[model samples]
Structures are given as structure tokens and as C-alpha cells.
Target: MTGEPVLLTCDSGGVRTLVLNRPHRRNALDAELWEALRSALVDAGADRSVRALVLTGAGDAFCSGADLPKRPSTAHPLHRMRTLTEVTLLLHELPMPTVAKVTGVAVGAGWNLALGCDLVIAVPEARFSQIFARRGLSPDCGGTWILPRLVGLQQAKRLALLAETIDAGEALSRGLVTWVVAAADVDAFTDDVTARLAAGPPVALAQTKALLNENTDRTLREALAGEARAQAVNFATADAPEAYAAFAEKREARFTGRWAVPTRTEDDA
Candidate 1:
């Protein structure tokens, strides 16, 4: 609210919520909005206190897509497109968990933005479409990379090629969205999910997210090695000891968000 009219940011209970504020244009991504969004994501990534992020829209629609001018701009198109690419990659690579709360239409780049999140929860009436083809362009915003991974190659092609709008139920069935609930229940559901994520051990959750995100590209041996390394790192964190203590005491573990991986000494070796 303090910055541009395009985005509104709020923090509560270790969760940072970024709401797209352009309601009239259905929260479409303009150049300025894109820059603001990237800045916000970067800040969230750097803030250790921010355990989770939620992306939503201020109005009924999540986002309509890019707000292109009727005539071509003098500015370089690829430069602008690269900005969007940066935003998508930042969101995908951010250490903390991210969730997209979808309500109305999430189309083209907008839909892809939601797909970039670690989890997406939508209302029953929410709609989604890969509408770039209809605009005489192919999908960007990491849509090509994420869609096939989520719904398989054939389905990815069909959805992109057809540019058809599908409701939240179909999106859930196709693995595009993690969950779908009634419009009335979306707020409560999202709150519960994000709260749980926020309370989770930061280092362990981050390590798990990194492992799963990269698992598809690594060999089994490499994955096993990576898992061992991640476990070693986890064991060095204060949360690891807290987890054990809590298990013994039958109480919830308190994580301080401290990530200190101890150095190995000759004695340990």
C-alpha cells in the first residue's frame, strides 16, 4: 500500500502476503507491477522471519494476464519479458514455501504465476487458462517448464494450444492446483495451510523443498548423496535438537529460525 498501486503487502504470523492490487484490469501485470512484484519476492527471500508467502489478488480476479498496449512500444520487448522471467525464477527458487490463493480468473501469465508457487489453493468458482496462444504468443513466465512437469507433456500441450478456460475442480484433477474448496471456505483453508508451513522447521522445510524441486533432474545416486548432505545440515541446526526434545516431552517443537550449520572438526572425522 505504501508503494505502487499495483501491489499490497502484509506480514503476519511469519507469513508475508502479496496481493495484486489492480482490480479494474483484473490484476494484470503491467511493467511497473512486475518490477514491484520482483522486489517484494527478493525482500521475502532475504527476510529469515518470513517463513511463508501467499500471493493473491485484491479483487475477484486473481489476474487477467499482461496489460499490453494497443500499439507497439518503443521499449525493447525482450527486456520487459526478461523482467517477468526473473520474477518467476525468484518465486520458484525462494527458500521459504509459497502459496497462491486463486479466486476468479487466472489466465496466461497469471495462471503460470500461480503454477510457479510451491502450492496453489483455489476456490470452486476459480477459472484458469493458458491463454498465450490466443494472443498469438507462446507461454512465458516459466509456463512451458512447469506445465509439462505438473500435468504431463500431452496435457500441457492441449491446455496451451487450446487456450481453454478450466474451473478450479478440473485444475485440481489435472494436478495444476493442490486443492480446491468452496469460495466461502478458501480463506480459512489457506490460513490453516500457511500457518502450518510457517510453524514448520525452516531449515528442514527449505532443504526438502530444494530436494523435491531438483529431484527430477538428478540421478538416484546424486539424489541419495544430496539427501545425506541435507540431513547433515539439518542435524547441525538448533531445530534438530528442539525436535528431539519436543518428541520426548510430547510438546510442540519451537523453531527459532536459526540456521547454523556447524563446521566439522577433526574429532568428528
Candidate 2:
């Protein structure tokens, strides 16, 4: 534990997988892993080649939430929470798609972490809980906001107020997880799903994600205006033309996400 990195990173097929590496503690996030996650997310956001991202853990468990034994910071509680807030915002707002691959325990902030991703693929053995009330704390890491949105207020209350651990099947039924795959097939399924997402038109996907995230607050008029702007931006990328051509030719579109808008040259100036 002394020399091993708190987070492990891997890149393959345009996907970046960030593994939470504290398995001995059920991959509970500590100060070091939190900072590492922030750095990794920033790097991924800046690298357009990384079209998809995956968040998982090293051993059996995905995460058991923040490590209670280790006090991560001596600063004020507000300052400490800001670190978590940053990580939450980064994961939620990443331009590319994100997936959470949960195998075992995903509780407290860990469950919220999975919820923050665009999709969650959990194995049959996966267990989830809010676990905040038990810890005498309310939800953090965007749980308070995301839970109600995903499962509705009543169910969200049942989870947060009671902090009951729910199994994978129940989680799926309650909309806590996107899919509950067999433990044997989780790796292959995750790879296939991420690859398919990566192969899609990046510009359109990003815009779509943004649109959905903002939809909750915007009015009908505002939402339509946003979509119009998004479509205009999409047309300025190489993906839109490729999509049209592929549709006409009845072939799969290979989107490159290359910018196609004309640049102002010295002569134009």
C-alpha cells in the first residue's frame, strides 16, 4: 500500500479507464485518489483522442465511498468539500461519454460517483447504498441533486434517509443503474458499449449530453433555442456531413469530429 499508486490509468481504443486503486479499503476514495482523479479528468477533457472514459476500481469493489479513517484535509469542511465538488462537476460535465463499471460494493459517495456518469454497467453482485444517514451526513458528491432526478423524490428519500443497501436488480428497477449485466460478461459488455459510443459522432454526442444536462432547468423556448445552436455547431464539424453521406449510401458513418468551419485568413482581414 505504501508504494502502490492510489489510482491506475489505462488507455485503449480511444477510451481512458481510471481505476480506483484502494481495494483493501473497498476502493474508498482518499485525498490522494481524489486529486489524482481531478488530474486524470483534466487530461482526458483536454485530449480529444480520448473519446470515452470509464471509471472502475482495482479489485472486487467499485468503491465504498470516502475513507472515514483517514482525514484527508485539515482545512475547513467547506474547503474539503470543494475538492469533492470539483471532481463531481468534472465527471458530470466531461464533453465525452463516461461509464461506470461497478462489480461489487458501491456505497455512499461511491454510488453517487456511478450516478454521475452517463451510463452505469453493474454486475449482478453489485450492491449500492446512499449510506449517508448512517454516517450522520447528508449526501455529497452530487448525490442530493442527481438522486431525485434519476429515481424521483420519494424513492430518493427512501435511499438517502434510510441509507439502505440495494442489490443490482433492485437498483436497475429503480433506475439507479443503467444495466445489470452478469458478472461473467461485464468486461466484454463494457468494452463493446464504450467502443460503440466512441465510434459515434463526437460533436453530436457532446451536444446531446449538454442538452440533456441543461434540460431540467430550461423552459421549452430555451431548450429549442439551445438545440438550434447545437445543430448549427454540429454542422460545422466533419461528423455531420459524414452522417448525411453515410445515411444516403446506407453505410456506417465514420465520424472524425474534425472542425470544418472556414477560418479567417489574412486576405479576409
Candidate 3:
């Protein structure tokens, strides 16, 4: 953490929000910001108090992209790419869910960064674009891989090929964002969503996220088997039994065991 902290960090309730603080630059990612973000993400993942994480930016913009002016000055391109790949993996593999709160432009790698999260909530002012082609560069930060998986191949192609910007409503219509709200409602909507996720059964939520990620790469038979195994493990948890009892008693389930991450019986086999 250097250069005036690189980013802003705030923890409220059980949610940790990392806001990209370089508002003057529209939250452009320089090497320092990337490193600081990775460190912050690691710390948040390790903190048991954090039930969910939010990635946003200061000012109106979520992120414009990687710092374009510094690209030519970067000495180790391959190393930087590797670091970014690790960061993406970390976001995907974190035990807690992540939500990207986008109120303004999210372009190039910035768009990819938001895609890396589990969910995205955007305001009416939000804009998404794949600007690599416009810059005479191919997709970086796994944008090519993640975008198609998100909004399908054709839509991804249209955006990446033309480097066109799409507004929030169009993003929602294209399934690019999980939720869309009015510009003024972005903060409230993000807080509400994060609060709901934080209040969920931590163990189950983690398991569900893992299962969804795993199933994305699994065959039908494998997915069914994996679902059964996951269900069996969930059924054995204390929370599961409590849930059943409460349901039978016609009341909300009071799960006292918080943040109980279930061990995976097997890797993605």
C-alpha cells in the first residue's frame, strides 16, 4: 500500500467494500493500484468478518481501464499479465461472494474486472465496453474468456469487435449485469444486495457459489453427481438440520454457526 493508500477500503456489517480511489484518473489501474487491489482482496478473503465483498470506484466512474499512459512504461509485461491472472483467479475462488458496483464507465480491463466478480449491480449511468480493439490490442485480463461465458458469444463479439459502449439497461437486457437501478439508487441497491447476501447461510452460500463455478465446466453427468455430493454434505451440516427444524416449526431458521465453510469432498474431477 503506497502512494496515498492506492485505494479506499471500508468494512461495514459483514461486507468489505474496496473502492478504487483514483477518481481524478477515473480509477485507472496502474501497477501500484493492481498490486494494492490484490493485497486488499487477499486480506478481505482471509478475514472471517467479511461475508461478502464489493468492488467499486470513487467519483461517478467505476473504472475507465488499465492506466493507458503507463502501459508503455511497464517493464515486465508478462509478469504483469501473470499477476492479473492470479488476481482474477483469486476473485473467482474466494469463499465469499463478490459484487461489482458500477455507476459509470467500465471499459477495457475494467469491464473484465467487473465480469470477474460473482455478480454486478449497475446504475443507469453505468457503461460497459471492450475497448481493446479500438486500441489495436486483443483482450487482456481474461476478458475474451469471461465475457462470452457471461453474455454468450455473439453479444460478446459485437462489443469486443466494435468496442461499443452499452448502457445499464442494455447491459441488464443482455444479462451483463445482475441488477440495474436508477443512478441515485446505486449505493442503496448495492448495500441492500450485500446485506442480503451477508445474512444468508454462509456455508450454503459458499457451497452454492463453488458448485455454480464448478458446474460451468462440468459435463451433465458430472454436474448431477457433484450436486448430489454437495447436497449430502450440506444435509450433514448443523445449519441444515436447524433449517429443517425451523421450516417444520414454521419459523425462520436461526443458524448460530456463522461462516462455516464446508470442505470440498473432492476437487473438480
Q: Model 1: per-residue lDDT, tens digit, 94-154?
A: 9999999999999999999999999999998899999998999999999999999999999
Model 3, 111-196: lDDT tens per residue? 98998899999988788899999889988877888788888899888989999988888999888899988877778888999988
TM-score of each: 0.94, 0.97, 0.90
Looking at model 1, residue 249 earns an lDDT score of 100
Model 3 whole-model lDDT (C-alpha atoms):
0.85
lDDT for model 1, please: 0.92
Residue-wise C-alpha lDDT for candidate 2, range 1-269, written one tens digit per residue: 99899999999999999999999999998888999999999999999999999999989999999988453556889888888999999999999999999999999999899999999999999999999999899999999899889889999999999999999999999888899999899999999999999999888999999999999888999999999999999989999889889999999999988999999999998
Q: Global lDDT of each model?
A: 0.92, 0.93, 0.85
- Residue 247 Cα positional deviation in candidate 3, in Å, after optimal superposition: 2.4
Q: How many residue pairs clash (N, CA or C atoms closer than 3 angstroms) in each of the candidate models, in the order given?
A: 0, 0, 0
Off by over 4 Å in 2: 70-73, 266-269
Q: Model 1: residues >4 Å from true position, as ranges?
A: 1-4, 260-269
Q: Alpha-carbon error at 175 in model 3, in Å?
A: 0.1
